[model samples]
Target: MSQYGKLMLDRYPEKMILPESSVIMASDGTVLRRIPLPETGYRIKAGLGEMPQLLIDTFIAVEDRRFYSHKGLDYQGIARALVNNTVRMGVSEGGSSITQQLARGLYLNRGQNLLRKLNEASIALTLEKQLSKDEILQLYLNQIYMGQGQYGVKSAAERYFGITDMKHLEIGQIATLAAIPKGPSIYNPVDNLELSAGRRDLVLRIMQQHKLITTEQMRAAMKGPYIPPVKDKTEIVGASYMDAAIKEAMRQTGLSRKELCAGGYTLVTGMNIEAQRAMERAFSQEEAFPPDGKNQRAEAAMVIMDQRNGEVAALLGGRNPSTGGLNRAVTPSRQPGSALKPIIDYGPALESGKYTPDSLLPDIKTTYGSYSPANLNGVYRGQVSMRVALQQSINAPAVWLLKQVGVSYARGFAVRLGMELAAEDNHLAIALGGLHSGVSPLMMAQAYTVFANGGILNKAYLVRSIRNSQNQVVYSHVAAPQQAISVRTAADMTAMLRQAVSEGTGRRARMDVTVAGKTGTTQLDLPGVPGKANRDLWFVGYTPRWTAAVWMGFDHSDPDNYMTAGSGFAAAMFSKVLSML
Candidate 1:
């Protein structure tokens, strides 16, 4: 490697190349998401060609009038600055060329020490020989930090003027941003407008004198109607989805975190903006969940999937989709509550061919070692059909049925449905939604699709494809469908779930269109909490068009005031999202 290459890596390690955001777009080409770059700096990558002539000229005129004429250092400018500083007894101006400035920003510390200054100069000279003037300028434009957590010309333009293309910027706006690098704290147009305007006029004056802008253009720009941007807070879109997609992409592509961020990849996802917006509106409602306060807060998550293709239509990880926090839809394995019964116990029971929907099952309570269970309403009929037993979600009957069919069979079935069941998961309590680890909303939703899609099981996926800067496809999705169960079994299970929704605990999820689903509410014993309350609530359901699962609960451990009602929380939210479709 050359000296400049070594210097670039030694100072600004390849890892410090600065992260560029990957865009997430919907299937129909609608741009759905961009994760908010951290407060460290927000830089949307762009080439030198993206810079406008006016903005580029303004920068050169104000910062270095002899920029194009200089090789890497301007001896005359340095002499003048030295003379001026000696007379003033202070450093008022910098003599570094644009290439020198880029070197400092990229590979040197922000200090005025002589040793650092000499190093900066050495590196700048080396860089000029190694790269073109335009390349150095592009790096400078991207690495320079503007005020308010923005880096790069493209991001700054978008933040300050709502303009993605720099060429679209007005003359006054161009001058305003050009003046910011002098002292962003003082000349930031967003916070201190009056000071910024004065600096902008000074830059315009220089442009006029340098003949970079016409005298008439300078006068109009100085008169100034610079409309600053209105977005004070960065509005991130589909952050949760993007967050998961990046992780998945990294695993599949075997790219490091820095490489993935710096690759400038474009991710196309199965997100439907309409469905996502509807889910967002549902959570944003005035009464979606209990109010949050202090260290304690109620949280909920939902995942809507296209059953036929296993494409994730919409996913809300938590209340704040922009946070990119723990994605409950894909992580945070919580007990599926009664939602597990249909797939784990009942669905497999019918698929085994030994049991039919009309077959009689014992609903009477019986002891299973030290564990005994009761129905939700505390009333159990002596004998009931399998359909009625499932509809009522009778706990005793489910437990007995698991024993009759053998616990291994039900647990194995859940594993085949894409759930990673363990030895601890193979117990009679598994029939009553008891498990080793909880299920994610994504897994639960996909499992239920076996019935909705007529036994075809498609792997739930968010990203459909990824492309690089050359518009060449780097990654594409291949459809993999498995026949998880018999068509006869899927049809029978679908009928039973529909009956449950129409007449049982899932009645709260009634929709105008035909729907099949199960509501699950699990009450676990708390150490010191009172009232024998349930902690987790879940609603896993599917329509012919979409399969969805909803989970509502407190993020913290169950306290004395744990809320555990699935019908009102999960079921209602499910209805809100599904009804819109």
Candidate 2:
């Protein structure tokens, strides 16, 4: 028996079970929201000493009359239940003691079979040898399921009766709570009040018969007024931000969603509520976007991050956002157009020690194999400096420079800046963002951090720290900055991008603070289409303090559903969001 007890104790989990919810908080310690476990609703723990005397006595009388006297199982109670159930011709009574019930709940599933019953009895004996009677009772009261998705007595009391303190509960309310664990669904107070009240009266009679309560006390308790459950009114603000934070936390801690939901953790995130609300408001205004036809609306996503430490301040997955929906801010579906020019073309060329901002390159129409690249306007300068070529976002010179730098070397440089490229992305079309799979707005923002942070890439993250239920720090963020390019390369790229924003194609994104950015537009090719219709528009920009990437397009690109205003509209939206910050 002793050896079996030791083996069971060794196999027990360090932390027995996960709690109800994980609290997500902002950096300033303001609670953003509580993410509840899907299986169990909400649980607030109450120790055995905190329970009222009437509640305890009633539970003991109704659940297990020999609870204190029995070691783990009550033979007399089991014999009586077997005889009664045999007489009734069905299994209607449970002969398990309180300790046995606790063991079953903690270790075994609710399967009605002889093998499971034997296993439950063995575990019950092991628990009795290891734990005191008070310890077993406390665990049972805190883990037993009540009705309405509540787990423990404290959660049930506060949820059903709005009583936070268990001692403040009325006699009838206490009896009602104690009667729920038998069959929570059948006797749920909120769903079936009369049935729950009848169960409460049965508990009162049992307490009286056990001499735990007087007849007058039981009668008065049964005659009390019935109270209904109050509705929970906690509003979930910033669904998109919450969704991103949950994903990031899971990635950082290597825990699954179910584990995080039940771990009772405090996830401190870098979300700025004011900035999140401002971005949501900006996306809410329809006039800020291009005039898509009445039947279809253009979709957009934006991500903002602190360039200093890579903390994601605010994010918008889409115009009409829903949690766990297609998060376009992090989903890479559309091409980036000329946004790849700065990172893959100019930055890598300058980092090679063979090119500078003033290095001359050809901008005329050219072809390598069957692929020929052209400027957006079908006009180009013969030989322009690299700065001039980047400011105007000339496509011919970018492809020429990528050819000169060697596609393999240039792509290697891009990979270090956080762009996920495939083997098929190995041609001159990469200079024009014609990859098999394009990059997301999150990848764009993180890649630009190299230039903003002077050649060091700060990986973007949402969660700053995570604390377990015992208030111990389980995980914290540490800076892991990698040098992706030379300091001179970052400086020259920033200077050229600033010119692009101030005087060239990105002028719509210019603001009071010194801004550096690039504009990109991918044109749609429809057979016999007269004019250039854009399928995607992108603007990736950064101030000294913040970096943001914005993308505007349709969810599905067709001849009828495309952008009419080009990347300037995306740049203008970036400016609008920047002003609010």
Best candidate (score: lDDT): 2
**Span of 10 residues, lowest total lDDT, candidate 1:** 32-41
Best prediction by TM-score? 1
Counting clashing residue pairs in each candidate, in order, gives 0, 0
lDDT of each residue in 1-581, candidate 1, tens digit only: 24654566566655345566656688888766554454445678788787888787778887777877887788888899789888988766568888778878777777876666677777777777777888777787887877877777788888888898788888888888899988877887887889999999999889888888899999998997668666535234566777787888888788875566555678888988788878888888858775443455678889999999899988889887564478888884788878888887788788788999998998887998988877867787899999998898888888888888887787777766777676767667888887777788898998998889998889888889988755798888889999988899899999999998899878878799888999888775777755446677889998879999998876765463576444457887889888987
- Candidate 2 lDDT (Cα, whole model)? 0.85
List residue ranges in candidate 1 displaced over 4 A: 1-18, 24-39, 229-239, 256-263, 284-298, 319-324, 367-380, 468-472, 526-532, 556-559, 564-568
Instruction: Provide the global lDDT of candidate 1 against the true structure.
Output: 0.80
TM-score of candidate 1 to 2 decimals: 0.89
**Backbone clash tally (model 1):** 0
Per-model TM-score, in order, reads 0.89, 0.78
